[model samples]
Target: MALPPADDLPPLRAVVEAHGLAPRKALGQNFLFDLNLTAKIARSAGPLDGFTVFEIGPGPGGLTRALLAQGAERVIAVERDPRCLPILSEISARYPGRLEVVEGDALETDLAARARGTPAKIVANLPYNVGTQLLINWLTANPDAPFWTSMTLMFQKEVGQRIVAAPGSNHYGRLGVLAGWLTRSEILFDVPPQAFTPPPKVTSSVVQLTPLAERLACDLDRLERVTHAAFGQRRKMLRQSLKPLGGEALLDRVGIDPTRRAETLSVAEFCALAQAL
Candidate 1:
């Protein structure tokens, strides 16, 4: 049986048509109109009774509606697309004071300040092109104390795998190292390509990342430098791939085997190397 409508408002399809809002390729837009899926994505962030949700790219407000209906205390949606503003405005009207639509680029918006030190959860079907960069920004933003309590995001399957990939795995790289260093991340579920409006070519997955109460102490810049050099030539031995960064000597000083490949090094090992640098 079909799930009941998430809210009393018009269906997402009608909302999309009425607003003449088509997904734009330049913005990496792919509309997810399934209320069931959107609700599931919102719930994956855990209980929303008192937490404010920071959502990016809420096109036509499908996920916005689900989050409000699911009882999120407040939703601060940052949307870059001017065309989506009015559509989201309608939903804001429906929900009264529960929604705040910020019309601006998410990259330029300071989410930490917008959240105003409240316990916040970031839940969004992130745009594909800028997803990884966005994740990197959030991870490196405040190492001492993350701006948000938790993040539940959607990415292409490959990107999601990289976020949760382990040492010695094919997907392990800079992303996994940074994410592992700061948060405990995992792939919650895979979303098939067919589920989207202008269905994407590849499958997508939802990943959840919870901040570690106590993170390892290491220079974030140094870690990025090491990972960039090591993975820049992943197939090469550490001694060869990282030659520019004091290479073999640096690894030897850290007591790491210079012959080990980037993918074979654990997150802790990487942190040690970064500290040695």
Candidate 2:
């Protein structure tokens, strides 16, 4: 008999149990078994019809299956856990040529190369341990020509707030500055911790970031340095907090008031400081 369509596969929990794959805390695995929720996330990434979707930590293929069923051109999932490979292979077999599973740490893999110069998007429920760092890696991968056209990611809610936070908000920090400087980011919606296989202590949010078609170009390291130092001592005045980076002189050169606190600076102001440095 012909196999069931890709969308008609058994429930995610069944598949996980069949493969003896239990969520591993060591690997930051919290599988989302709800297909409807996963599908909403897939659509939130915008049209995936002709773009490759690069997914990280696709435990049990919840979002992977959703991306394929939603019409992604291809999905290259980088999974660190060897246990999940079999399930992913099952997905690949069901979808035939549409899915490719790479067994490795996503941190070390080059997703851009995987896309092979084609327009691509990244959608994943990133492992908590490396989510922020992974985002930084992608954001700074190559500012001049970002490999992924857009990124739809899930992060701890507080972290998500920082990404889309504006100047003066308590959430505004290094992530906010960098993300705001490079792209337009917004929190699509909140995902309660209860949604996962083994729930996390904190709530999560799905955030989408689209690169600005035209943004003021600035050096990544310099921006990182400025934000790190400035926010490192967030309550201090620019003159005092930015002392390691030429402090008062740097602010003056960038036409910023030295007495202003780090949180007062806009994303553009932070970039200005970096460019001035």
> lDDT of each structure?
0.94, 0.92
Q: Could you say which candidate leads in TM-score? A: 1
TM-score of 1: 0.98
Q: In candidate 1, what are the lDDT values of residues 1-277, reduced to their tens digit?
A: 6788888999899989998889999999999988999999988889988888999999899999999998999999999999999999999999999999999889888898988888999999999999998899898899888888899999999999999999999999999999999999999999999999899999999999999988788999999999999999999999999899999999999899999999999999999999999
Q: In each prediction, how many residue pairs overlap at the backbone (N, C-alpha, C within less than 3 A)?
A: 0, 0
Among all windows of 10 consecutive residues in model 2, the one with the lowest summed lDDT is 1-10
Q: What is the TM-score of each candidate against the true structure?
A: 0.98, 0.96
Between which residue pairs do clashes occur in model 1? none
* RMSD values, in order shown: 0.8, 3.0
Which residue runs does candidate 2 get wrong by more than 4 Å?
Answer: 1-6
